[model samples]
Target: MALSEREQQVLRDLESQLHQEDPGLADTMDSRTTGPLRLSPRHIGAGVALVLVGMSLVVGGVVVRNSVISILLGVVGFGMAVWGVTLALTRVEAGGGPGSSRRPSRRSSFMDRQSQRWDRRRGSQG
Candidate 1:
């Protein structure tokens, strides 16, 4: 349900107060985005390279005669493929970019708040 004008105004006031009191927290909260994952070209390139190398290794493993060597190669190849997939699927942060340095304390505090909320929810459920 949509908020009424009065509720909206109150929310705005609260947000303004939050910004004034803790600008870092406000900024971090505002920077959060939802929806589709955005992948960078660099990530795509690296992930693809790893995946290709992995595929080649897997193929080589299948062709090899020795069971021990084949098994090792196959395991490594599977690991590399999974890593590549994970890297490729990872979302890039939009607002700050990867290079922008944020206060460590702010992040930890936000995480702590989320953890507390999760704990509270679980406690209520159980």
Candidate 2:
């Protein structure tokens, strides 16, 4: 059921009061809702362990001389390894949260360059 207009206003007022009363709790709640998944060192370690288990599965499949299973397991292992690396290295920050004043880097990948070109074309036409 939709909230009535008065109920909506009351909810907004409560939220504003919450921010004013306990800023730390507000920040934690905001981070949980708006922030990226902040993986800890232990989480990254678990991801590495998962990659190792996937590799072992691939090796066992190969020993059993199952081509299909071996290929599938190998692919899974590769994906897990890539995921672990990403978890280890990725730095996620909320937009305009902190240190957001830095200028964008000029380096552009092939896809980035193509996307920029497409955007410019659309902008000029419009």
Candidate 3:
């Protein structure tokens, strides 16, 4: 059987309260969010671009028959490629800000009513 009108109303009221409390909580937890942890092909492409540029430099050095310059370009190009790829693929944690139950942060943990005691002690020393 369908839910009674009262049951539906209660659900709606609870939803309203929850949304008002944290408007984006639903969006954050959406499985479709995919987090910010993965790298896209575009990131890899950029790194490869760096490598190509470095390879071109090496080619130029070759035309001049300069082994030292070729080596330098190769090193620079390889470094750029590595750095670009590294930067593109980092992920940060997802927290439900404020009242979302993630628990206290390292900084916030030590900043509670204990501050009052510390303040009183400091005041006495002053």
Candidate 4:
């Protein structure tokens, strides 16, 4: 999904506000996190090559009249092809990507409160 120009501007404005309020945090967040799982051309190529090799292996086994070997090669080829397709189709974005700038939800707030309480309790006991 692509963001509209207005939405992009809003995000930029929010980021500026954040930077002004917390320069230290802003500096810490300057790193570009890797985007989601995307199959690079290299990975796709490697996967395709693997599938091809496996298929060839299966064909060779069949030519040699070895049922067990043929079956094993076929399974390997299928698995490799599936893995390649999955890698190519699935994409995951890391931090700094779209929708990553949103504030934490209520559940996250609750978890933070609970963690703080636990820390306080431990400190008092100690």
Candidate 4 local lDDT, residue 124? 100
- Cα displacement (angstroms), candidate 4, residue 18, comes to 21
Where does candidate 3 clash, by residue pair? none
At residue 69, give the lDDT of candidate 1: 90
Candidate 4 residue lDDT tens string, 5-94: 999999999989989999888776763342344445554566677667656765665776677877777777677667766655544433
- Can you write out model 1's per-residue Cα lDDT over 1-126, one digit (the tens) per residue? 999999999999999999999999988788763423477777778888899889888999999999999999999998898888888777775433365547545787899999999999999999
lDDT tens per residue, model 3, 2-74: 9999999998898788778887885565444654444455556766676667566656656755778777776
lDDT of each: 0.83, 0.71, 0.65, 0.68
- Residues 8-118, model 2: lDDT tens digits: 999999989999999999888988788565545554676777767767776776776678877887787777777767666555453332344453333335558989999
Model 4, residue 46: C-alpha shift (Å): 1.9
For model 4 the local lDDT of residue 20 reads: 100
TM-score ranking from best candidate downward = 1, 2, 4, 3
**CA lDDT, candidate 1, residue 25:** 91
Q: Could you tell me every candidate's TM-score relative to the true structure? A: 0.55, 0.37, 0.33, 0.36
- For model 2, the stretches where C-alpha displacement exceeds 4 angstroms are 1-39, 92-126
The candidate 2 region of ten consecutive residues with least summed lDDT is 95-104
